[model samples]
Target chain A: MTKIVVLVKQVPDTNAKIVVSGDRVDLSAVKKVMSPYDEFAVETALRHRDASGGEVIALTLGGAGADKVLKDAKAIGVDHIVRIDCEEELDSNSLQSALASTLQEMGAEIVYCGKSAADTGAGSTGPGVAERLGWASASNVTSVGFDGGLTVVAPSDGGNARMSVNTPAVITCDKGDIKVRKPNVKGIMQAKKAQVEVKTAAIQPSSVTIVAHSMPPAKPAGKSYEGGAAAAEVANLLRDEANVI
Target chain B: MTELIVIAEIAKGTIHTTTSELVTAANALGGSPIIIVPCTDASVADAAGTIAGASKVIAAKSDAFAHYDAAAWAEALDAVAPQGTILTSATPQSKDLAARLAARRNLSVVQDVVAISQNQLTSPVYSGKAMQTVAISGPAVVSVRANVFDAAPSTGSNEISVVDTTGNMATAVQEFMARASQRLDVAEANIIISGGRGMGSPDNFVHLEAIADTLGAAVGASRAAVDTWEAIPHSMQVGQTGKTVNPNLYIAVGISGAIQHLAGMRSSKYIVAINKDADAPIFQHADYGIVATWEEALPVLQSTLAGMMA
Candidate 1:
């Protein structure tokens, strides 16, 4: 059977207000959920496994709190789930290295992940993993199909490119017609009993270091206009003050 | 002297505007700036040589580079780039190439950097909620956001040096397709007119396209519009899950400001929001907000912009 792995990350809800204090971003009060885009990734992997007769394994690298996303993945029909236990933050290089090694050991032929983590928004892990494994990769993939061969549709500039890559490849999922299905009552019950396999990974040394953090300069207060007649005034401001006209 | 290398971006035999911006960025650091033009054609390299602020242009040409392949480009760049800082415009291709190069060199990539100094770089983290300043210990790869830096003036005495590849390519492009002519990418557009779900239907996007054409702007969309309508592709999506746009002017029509959407465009220099709901969240971030429906405001705004431009 084709072995597939989907990488998911737990991130603060998109609407949470991020508070940056000193050198760290304070997220103690935020509600954590599966990174929004990872939903599409999980759905994509399950579809691929169902079509090709494979076992879909969901993997996540985070602290113990990340088990919430793993159970959620199990409820969504992932065959197996594993979590790499780590508390300290791992940079992209270290994270990708750990994932590449783990996926290699699992003999995974196909790997799926979100294009970028919502928290860091680095958008590098998928491609970095591909490079580490010496495999072909595609990013921002909107669709995947199995028509005698695996075909992926990706958006490029203003057009779309339908691409086909060899196996042992990494594909980053983007939103498309695939609406992530909700877990049914039975699925939720099954997920509650699912056992999450925990594993330890050797953290790699980081090459880049963050020295400090600061808030972006706040935007000036907005000017509100009342009616359609305000169009002329807005245009005048665009031309005179904003100089964009 | 520290040798700062810039990977010049070439499209359809011409240097992209972002390459000159990278040159300007490279000039900010105290070093001898050089441009690396990796292309199949030599004329594109000659075009890159004319860019200002660069001391020399190294054109790495090979048949393997006839199309855009990140692995091949990264290999060519690794071969030509000296032991110093490497910079490129933060496009989809560049991001992939930078990541590959960083992994190959055991270095870290600072993606979508907005500000840079000799040793320190500042970039948006957590989808623009906060900015992080990182210190580079030695050689590193950096991808810069387009249109953030001024394009360098064309007055350089740079010479072009040609190098042939060894034909050791791991990946090949089966085909390359270009976008429609005159369509600007949201990331590089100076002005953008974006529609949201409040516009109600896919047919109403024509209103945004009309205004975009009038203002020479690109047409963008919030994630809601893209998810709701088949006509709006993911490429037009501007949000945390989509492309982050830093256009000079961003005009939102009928968009309720979601934090995810704001994360992509909150850095726009000026914002104008139009929504029928007076209490829409978009008005909070907009510089000038119109408390009217797009149907009531777009036509008048379009005619007024047409008159102004005409």
Candidate 2:
């Protein structure tokens, strides 16, 4: 059977107001949900497992609260859920190492994840994990078709490129024609009773460290133009002041 | 002085603009970086040698280097650049290559870096909600955001060095394909004009295109417009779930300034919003705003911009 693993993360709702306090972001009052893109990842994994006759497992490396995202994945038809209970911030290198080892232990042949984390926006985890495992990897894949091999379509400069890769590969999903499916009543009820198997991950020493956090310099108030007639002035400002045109 | 290595990007045997931008970034960090051009031909080294502020250019050529195979590029770069910080442009190909190099070297990687100093680098985290400054001690890999820094101009000619690997390759690219020519990606363009549901229909995008052509800007769309209209493809989407752009000038027409949309283009140097509702949330972030319908304002604006350029 094809053993597929989908990596997911819990992030603040896209509309949540971010409050920065003393070089740290405060998320005390923010509501967290499955990252929007991860929903697509979950959908992709379920479809692949169903078509290929395999088991789909949803995994996350986050704190206790991260269980919510796993549970959400269960509601979306994932068969198994696991969470690596850790709170320490991991740099990309250490994180990829930890996850690669975990996936290896599980004997997962195909791995899927969102192109990037909504919070960090570092679209490196999937490819990073693939590299650590010495496996083929594709990023920003829009569509997936399997016929003896995995064929995926990813956006290029202006068009899309169709690529083929062998299994034991990592695919970072992008929102394309795949519209994430919604959970039915029965699925939601079953997910509420599902248990998330939690375990600790071996945290590795980080090479990069966060020294400080600050707000980007605020842009000065821009000059306003009244109506369509102000277009000439806008053009002049774009050419002279901004030097963009 | 510390040594810096830059991974030069090449297109059609010519150095990409991002390579010059990397040179500018390296110059800011206090070093004359050596450029590494990985290509199928050694002649591309001539183009790499012309980049300003570079000390030397290393031409890494192999049959497997014809197309962008992340594994091949990573192996090639790792073989030549054993130590020191390595920098490249932050694109899908380069980011994948950087991540692979980081894993292979077991070093830290700072992706999409916007500012770099001697030891500290600043990059946007949480989709531009906050910025994190990281401290690096030993070897590291970093990818800079495109168009954020000025492209270093051609100044001094540098020496070229070639490294030939006739048979050494781990992976090979079976095919290489690119989008149609002359279409600037939203992320790489200096100016972008994006439309939203306020545009009313897909037909109204032509108005945006008229202005876009006049200003040499790429056209983008809000998620709302893309989702609502079948004519608008996901490729044109610029939002939290779509392409994140850091253009110089961003014009939002008929967009309501959704936070998701703001996350993508808020880093743009200049923003202009045109909507009929004076209370549209987009006005809060726009550098300049006009309270008029696109119908009433676009034609006049297009004509005025054409006249200005003429």
Candidate 3:
């Protein structure tokens, strides 16, 4: 049986307005939710478990706040839930290293995660952790199959490539055709009472540091046109002013 | 001085323009870059050797290059790449290699770098809600986002090195299915015109498509459109949960401009919003706002745009 592990990250709700206060991104007022793509990964993992008879475990990073995503995964019927307990910010290397070691300790045979997290939008965890564990990684994937072996269909160069790999590999998911399932009332109640296993990882010195944060430069006010009469002007403006046409 | 290495971007066994973009990025960081093109044939090096701003070009000729096997590619590229800063364009293929290469050497990796100033790398965090700037203490592998760094005139001549790392690769390629239709993806499109559920029906997207065809723009959909209509695939979605785009011109028709949708395309150079409701949030960010329905505005806009093109 395959030991499937899906990585989930908690991110600010997409609708939350980000504010910068003194070189820091103020996310305190924003509500957190599961990274949208990670839900797709969890759904794929759940399907794999159902078809192949393997246990699916959901893993998350950070402090108590991250437990919510794990519980969300649990509510969707993941076999187990765990968290990496660290309060401090770790750079990309340290973050990937911690995740790599934790997966190794968990005896993970196959790993699944989002193509990239919505928070950082830094699609590193899958390939980075796969490299640390010396395993193959198929990223930006639509489908992951397990009939004869592990196969994945990933988009590349405006085409789709069907690839197969050995075990002990990491797969990063894209939405593809999979329709994500929502949790039911009974599942939600079970997840509300689920206890999460917490563990600490071996931290390493970080090679990178976030020195500052800022908002993108604001744009000047735009022109407004009313009714269909302005359509001709808009087209003319695109040519003369925007120079895009 | 730390050596700057650029991993050339190859599409369909041919060099891509992103090679120069990577070279331009490396030059901006105050270094003469050496580009390495991963391939099984040495002929690939000839074209890359001519890219401007690079000091040298090395073709890492390898059997592992038969197809894009990440494990094999990382192992082969590692042998030729020296200890230094690695620079590449943030494409799906190369970004995967960048992370694996960094992990092999125990180095740090920064992806989707939009700006580099005074040894600091800045990228969008929280999906473009806030930008984070990071300082690298030492050598790191960085992937620069396409169409961001400014290009300047530079010099380059022929100094080529070829390394052969022909080894057994584990991953096997079963088949490659090319998409039949020549539709451009929203991520790679220079111009995009997106529709929302307000279009009334999926079939109404034909008007958007006609407009897109005239301007050579890709057709995109809001999350609402993709959810409301099964005909619209998720690939056409442009939003936080969908593909993030940074096109030159983004046209939003009949969309209410949800924060999630804006989060993806906010970086577009110019935005045009067409909606019946003037109070829609999209108008707040659009460079040009039109208060009219698609049925009323699209015909004129399409004919006008077609006339301009003609």
Q: In TM-score terms, which candidate is top? A: 2
Compared with the true structure, what per-residue lDDT tens digits does model 1 show for residues B10-95?
66566788899999888876665789887787777877766788889988888767655555666667777777778887877787
Better of 1 and 3 by DockQ: 3
Candidate 2 lDDT over A52-169, as tens digits, reads 8899999999888999999899998999999888888889988888898889988999999998888888788888898788887878888888765787887643456777776678
Judge candidate 2 at residue A166 and give its lDDT.
61
Error of 3 at B276 (Å): 2.9
lDDT of 1: 0.83
Instruction: For residue B121, give model 1's deviation from the true position in Å.
Output: 1.9
Segments in model 3 whose C-alpha atoms lie over 4 Å from true places? B152-155, B167-170, B178-180
> Which residue pairs collide in model 3, if any?
A119-B126
What residue pairs clash in candidate 1, if any at all? none
Top model by DockQ, which number? 3
Comparing candidate 1 with candidate 3, which one achieves the higher TM-score?
3
* Per-candidate DockQ vs. reference: 0.53, 0.56, 0.69
Instruction: Give per-residue CA lDDT, model 3, range A117-218, as digits (tens).
Output: 887887888988998998888898999887888899898667788988767899999887888888999889999999999999998999899899999777
Residue B252, candidate 3: C-alpha displacement in angstroms? 1.9
Candidate 2, which segments miss by more than 4 Å at Cα?
A: B166-184
Comparing only chain B with the true structure, the TM-scores of all models are 0.90, 0.91, 0.91
Candidate 3, residue B153: Cα displacement in angstroms equals 3.6
Residue A21, model 2: lDDT of: 84
